[model samples]
Target chain A: MQLDWFTVAAQIGNFLLLLWLLKRFLYRPILAAMAARQQRVAAALTEAQAKAAAAEALQHDYLARQQEQTASRETWLTQAREEVVAQRQIWLAQARTEAEEARGRWRTELQREQQEYRRTLQREAGQRLLALVRRALHDLANAELEAQMASALLARLHALDGETRQTLAQAARDGCAILTAFPLPEPQRRTLTDGLQQFLSPELNLDFRSDPTASFGITLTTPSQRLAWTLDSYLDGFAAELQALIPPAGGDNASAYDQA
Target chain B: MTISPDQTILFEFGFVRINATLVFTWLTMALLVGSARWTTRKLSATGELSPWQNLLEVLVEGVQNQIRDIARQDPGPFLPFIATLFLFIAICNLLAVVPGYEPPTGSLSTTTALALCVFFAVPFYGIRRHGWRGFLHLYLEPTPLMLPLNLIGELARTVALAVRLYGNVMSGGLVAAILLLVTPLVFPALMHALELLTGLIQAYIFAVLATVFIAAAATAQEQTANLSQSRR
Candidate 1:
């Protein structure tokens, strides 16, 4: 039931002291620690947000670059395809041109070969006709044939005009000779000699000779004057007619033509 | 037989006297301060907490929440005073079971000291928040005729606060002593265990009552000011 004022005052002081001590030691540090932890958490959340934003931006950039690359690649592919088509067209045109040139060269060469063949054929035909005529004459030739040729010569000498006979007789006075493709018999030779002396001159010396290449006929020769009555003349006229009848090479068939 | 620890004077000088209440009060204070120091030396701002730190945080947060709930305001300014009041009384009463131990709350002088602290703290907080003139005007609320009655009521309540705590702790001690003389065995032990529970409850009541008084003084003028403005 009694009270102690000293103890009461002491308790009050002790309580205040305790209050100050507890505030200093306990509440302040605990609150500070909790606040620090909250600050660190907030900072970490902010940093994470920033990193996420950066990552999103990077992803956007990467997508844009990838899209651009894809577009460029498509462009390149399109350009390449166009180039390929153009090159193909160019190569096709070149190929066609080369083919046409080759065909033209081939045709030209063929035409040249055909013209050469035609010329060779014409030459062969002419030569064959000439050889056939020569062979027929050679096969038929003998003393009898020469006697007929001598008679033809005598007729030709008798049928000569006076002026031609005198000109021939004068040409014969210088040097007189007779040539035949075949050797004449003794009578045909004497006949040719007498026909020549009587028709041309009495004192005209006469000579007879044989020549195989004399065109299968007789020919008379003097230094500057000559007379002939030979089958070779007829053969020359026949060969000229045959040549006129044949078509000429190279004028019409010089080039070859074709359609596309 | 002494009903209060103040009668048990252990030391005396010519004019100053040291009693059992003072000694036990010091002991209780040491226990509280030492434990607080030990737990708060290394506070972990992050990561896992130690068991002692966890217990201390729970105790402090619980006190803060109580003050905030009852006062309907921020508990920051009131936390230290109220927490100390509960801890000191609770520990003092709880230690009564120890042999040769005296609880300081069982003394009228100690309870008066605590009640006086609350009595003064009410005005201290009121004046700190609203100024002396505004706080002094509170006793004249409703009319000046109620001034003397309100003053008497405040004094009576303070006396009641002290007497109520002293009567409970002193009577519990007295009853245990008498029961020890009568039975000396299981009944006294049971009463001591019961005293522990009542001691905790009384500490809670004391702390809550102190918070109510302080909050009432602190915010009463602001309410009056608002009412006057509304009337105007």
Candidate 2:
């Protein structure tokens, strides 16, 4: 076999014409459609992402607002409790003060009434006693003219034991004796000097000064000691004896005597 | 180179002698038609194709895929034309193996015709895609001064495609013939294998060049359109 030029040329011409026709009719439309579809898909994805971001932003805002609302509510509640507590304390204090004032007023009124009642009872009792006394005297005056009698009665109180008596005598004579007049009474002076000499066991020098304020009393004086037995001293001793006899309700007799 | 009595009988057609080459060309066309029909009948979206149909589909799909990648578009509409071109060239190359068959691509006339078809189709598709103005603007690509160079480049590409296939296929056949005449036994088998290789290579070159031309036409048209719009 050999190569033929004419037939090959005819065949090639046919193939080229066919290719041109196919390209014109087929490939371009399909490519355009594919490109458009890709663009649409890309746009959709972008829009979806944008929507997701917006949703996230909204969620964040809602959460922040919720937290703010909760905080404000808590503050409001705390403030309200403080105000209520203050008001309640103020009311309680006012109630307690009013109760105390009412109690004070009731006590004052009761005291005033009690004083008036006491005064009335005493006056009534005194008037009754005076009437009774006058009646008895009138009755006794006629009876006394018929008969008269006279009698004397005496009782001896036992003195304390020796130790007690000695303790009392020593306490009474312990301080220095004093003479109030410029010239002492001879008996009183001698007795004071003798007592001091005996107690000292030797002769003692004494000085005396008169004080009108130490009236009607003997005061003995020595160079280092003095003793007072004035009327003011006697009164003071009597007062002390009376104070010891009447002890305060809860105090001991010994403590009362020591105070006197 | 003595012609046999049967060869002479087959050559006499009316008063003019019809070359054995013409018969081989007819045989190639017949083979193309038969294969095309067989491949078409086996085409199914459902099960596997027979081996022959599978081979045809692989060849078609390979060319189609190449065109689609280059053209950056669907090659479905162009499949018939490209597949036919590929099959025709393949069959023409294989015809060299048949007892009295010759390769059509080895002839200058056939190669020139193929080149002319590619040349004409490039402009035709460019015009179809971007109109007549766009087709003319292919010469003026890059700049007005580039028009002559672009034209020359286009001519050169066509010539190169035609000459490349013709030279390669013709030399292979010549070598096989010379080796067969010299050592008729061992060399013929080696020549046959070499011829088979040559045939496949030339077929591949032809299909690849066709795809490149189509891609260039489409791209040029796109550029021309863009230029005109920018100018506007």
Candidate 3:
């Protein structure tokens, strides 16, 4: 086998050329691409991690806000409940006060109406009683009835105490006077004079006066002392005594009367 | 028939003779360069890759891994030289089956050129890593009295590398030719197929040896420094 130094040199040159060419074309670009891809993948991973951290922080913030809002809502609800209860209590108290006031006014109104009814009943009864008495007096009244009522004067004079008898006797030094609803008959006048002269001095002279509107009664006056009794006076006194003996109509009326 | 592609000169202008070895080498380089350019033209940094691009990436990555494994260092600096040597030799040996195609690797000149490249690359990388003095210091390893033997060993190994490749490739082609003359059919075809296996293996062996030699030279200075420090 023969060696060609020239061809060896050319082949060496070719190998070197091939080395340079392959380095430029193949190794440089492929390795660069691989390295670039690795870097890009790393960057993507890093970015994803950052985004995850941020999202987690945001979630925590949202949770905290939600909890705070819940607490605030609870506080507001509690306060509102208290206010509602307070308002209800005030309303109940006001309603109770208004009801009491209305009841008081109704009671006053009822009392006034009862009093008016009683006054109307009393006036009607009094008028009827007076009419009945007048009618009775017209039917049964005569000189005899007048003389009988006049006889009570003697008893009234006899019932007087010694002090009052002396006071009357001393006051009767002036002439005595008498009043009546009608003019007295002779017999009735003598009877009243005889009865009055027993308590007073025997020298007491009597003056008699009559008025048509006066009560059907006798009245005697001796400047300071006079006495008389008549059928009209006797009837009016009996009616007043009957009214005083009657019981009260209602408990409310008795309490009202006591209060008045 | 001529035994070597170098003897098959197509043209001559004195010593500047154009031979079949140079032509085939040029053809191999063109194929390598063109394919490299084509595949790398749209090199994608992400996503799907074209089939050719995938094939090229596998080939390049395989070379890098092989270099890294043997050298125990970063494969970046030596990747192109080591890979190109394997690709050129393998392609040349594989093409021998084609009628009238003379493989450049079957010539002594091409193998010597490759081995000489390896021989020179060892010192070049070592000197670059540890300076010329540190690299030259490897010749006196063990003792200064062993310097002549060490020099002869270095030269002998370079010759062994060239001869081993050339002998394997040329003998495969020559055996096929001789068998064609003797049996003319099936035996010669079997030998040609066997030559393909041998060719690929020789390419692998040559690349591994080159890697070992270069790695030793690159790291020898530091090893020597450590040993000296330990001894002192």
Misplaced by over 4 Å in model 3 are: A55-260, B178-194
TM-score of every model versus the real structure: 0.70, 0.45, 0.66
Model 3's CAPRI class is medium
lDDT of 3 at A76: 95
DockQ, every prediction: 0.56, 0.07, 0.57
In Å, residue A197's CA in model 3 sits off its true spot by: 23
Q: Tens digit of lDDT per residue, candidate 1, span B1-232?
A: 8888899889999757899998898898888888888888888877898898888788888999999999898998898889989988999989998988999999999999999999999999888888999899999997899999989988888999999899999989999999999999899999999999999999999999999989987778888778778999
Residue B118 alpha-carbon offset, candidate 3, angstroms: 0.2
Q: Please list the C-alpha lDDT of all candidates, in the order they appear.
A: 0.86, 0.59, 0.84
Better model by DockQ: candidate 1 vs candidate 3: 3
Backbone clashes in each candidate structure, one number apiece? 0, 15, 1
- Which 10 successive residues of model 1 chain B have the least lDDT summed? B217-226
Q: Give the C-alpha miss distance for residue A148 in model 3, angstroms.
A: 8.0
Error of 2 at A188 (Å): 99
Chain A fold similarity by TM-score, each prediction: 0.57, 0.35, 0.59
Q: Candidate 2 at A163: error in angstroms?
A: 99
- Give a tens-digit lDDT track for model 2, residues A145-227: 11110000000001345564344345434444444523455554555556545444344444444554343345444334334
Q: Highest TM-score: give the candidate number.
A: 1
